[model samples]
Target: MAEFSDYIVYVDESGDHSLTSIDPDFPVFSLSFCIVKKDDYTRAVVPSVQALKFKYWGHDAVVLHEHEIRKSKGDFTWLLTDRARRKEFYEDLNQIMVDAPITIIASVIDKLKLTARYPRPWNPYELALHFCMERLLMFLTSMGQQGKRVHVVFECRGKVEDAELELTFRRIVGGANQWGWVSRDFSVMEFEPKFAKKSVNSTGLQLADLTARPIAIKTLRPEQPNRAYDVILTKLGQIKEFP
Candidate 1:
């Protein structure tokens, strides 16, 4: 009889994993895991995001995508017309992220350095996933959640990408990772991967989406002021940077 964990983790990524033609502006690939207790997710995070949507859109149908909001495209087009509303919206949204009782574990891969070092480098996404998943297990173990079943939610990329990610995730969680041992007591936490489409409007996935870029940017340019990253630092539990 396996018991479920009181926490759920949402995953999102920033930047493409492709080593070829890396964007000079944002060369790093980052994966963010937003871990939230079920109670806090239900009682705080969801309502706040929904309220923010309703306040501006008069409905909650609008998904909170980091790219869309930043670019004022898609459902966020109106934001471009009204600077005051946009500023207010951002302020409120930033406050919500700061106030949310969530833990973020992120991994950043410097693709430029990675390709420069290795003749044959592993896929940046897979490498970052491995790092985050290992730390995720460690975080769960620290919280006395060993043997507990925790669901990790990831936004679906495409069919092939999603399939590959799922496979990699299962392999790591099944103890096929760098640390080859599994405890008899099942001290390693069990994680079930759940994939949701981007249109699903998941609060956790959105929060994870909002976090990935900031962490990646901070890693790439530590001196640059990132207000979003500053807010995210409050919830950051662990951050891993890889060459």
Candidate 2:
């Protein structure tokens, strides 16, 4: 077995899994996994992001969230009214994404076409989770870290929903089916998934959330100019979206 680092993969979602709430123009669901070594996350990623927040607001309590930054809402009210400052702060955060020591693996589901093509399609969240986990394991394998285990941490929706998500992830890890059989052999992720709300102060989840929207935007609006996303496109895995 290959050696592996103790790592944590944080997954944050952009867009919804609800077929009913599908936006005709942007009907895509995206889940992004930001993988980092446990030690590096604490010694590097966390403090770096903290510095960025402090640089802007001079406060440690402020968190970096993509949607909130874009709309300039919530704790980011100061940024809302100041276009120049917001633009500068946003650029610095993107630099953090580039310089951070991590890997990005994501799955984007084209919900509008998925439901149309299949009368009974697979659940979007579950589908994305399956593919993302596979890619993460593959990444470990490629690095010759087959023996190192990775755990997935998801942003919570609620107690009930979070429990359901955890169960599904455990089942997947158990290799309950054909795909599971492959994961079982790889043996990279064997731990039960963790679900903590974003308010729990997880820098990893914050990073994942920051990256998820740019991915959704690129997938939903290919024609639009998105230089920020272009900067991180190289990190995206090769998993294709479902039809």
Candidate 3:
């Protein structure tokens, strides 16, 4: 059997918490995750994403615009909009999807409700981030039941007391171990802002931001089912929309 180190999981986030500050009418907050196995990293994900860029922009380069992919606008829209090309693109994407082991998780938050619940004027981005990380950890614990260890690599939010995040992660990991959800020696590694940028592009982060947009739009009429869209809604207070 392959060891957990034989695979790599990279995670990232999208959208700004201060959308209301920019455009008070259109506030959106979102978090996203994108996971890939180690062997598939070089063989499938990298090449397929590069192909996706080429197919969309007629050039092979690293594309980082979340709105382009999320909104399917501009060239991205063109690629998916074109019938023959869209078929080819989806074919390639399906091949990559089948070849690689991947999973995506996201949470969307309604900022107005979040403010009413917390009312501390704290950094909403950080709050949403912690919620994303906690849920990701929980999912990994549940998936590790097949005697497989999970190695997680996530982008770090540049904050002073982020050490607390590490400590909290360890505690949760310990609890998962006690429950036999994971082995006693699993590990997590966080990347600096620079390296994270060069690593895998996170689609989950983009999805999270997208999920948050609608809820923020519907702040005047919030519903309970909207809260259930996110996995961390109960703990974080009606902030996330999950898919």
Q: lDDT for each of the candidates?
A: 0.88, 0.79, 0.47
lDDT of 1: 0.88
lDDT of 2: 0.79
User: For residues 127-147, what per-residue lDDT tens digits would candidate 1 score against the true structure?
Assistant: 888778777777788888977
Best-fitting candidate, measured by TM-score?
A: 1
> Residue 179 CA error for candidate 3 (Å)?
23
Model 2 Cα lDDT, one tens digit per residue, 1-243: 333367888889888898878888779998888888888888989989999978987877876788887777888888867889878887888888878888888889999889998888888988888888778877767766655556678888998888888888877767755433345453453554778877787888888888888888888888999876776686666545776
List where candidate 1 sits over 4 angstroms from the true fold: 178-187
> TM per model?
0.94, 0.90, 0.52
Arrange candidates by TM-score, highest first: which order? 1, 2, 3
**Ten residues in a row with the worst lDDT in model 2?**
178-187
Q: Which of the two candidates, 2 or 3, achieves a greater TM-score against the reference?
A: 2
RMSD in Å for model 2: 2.8
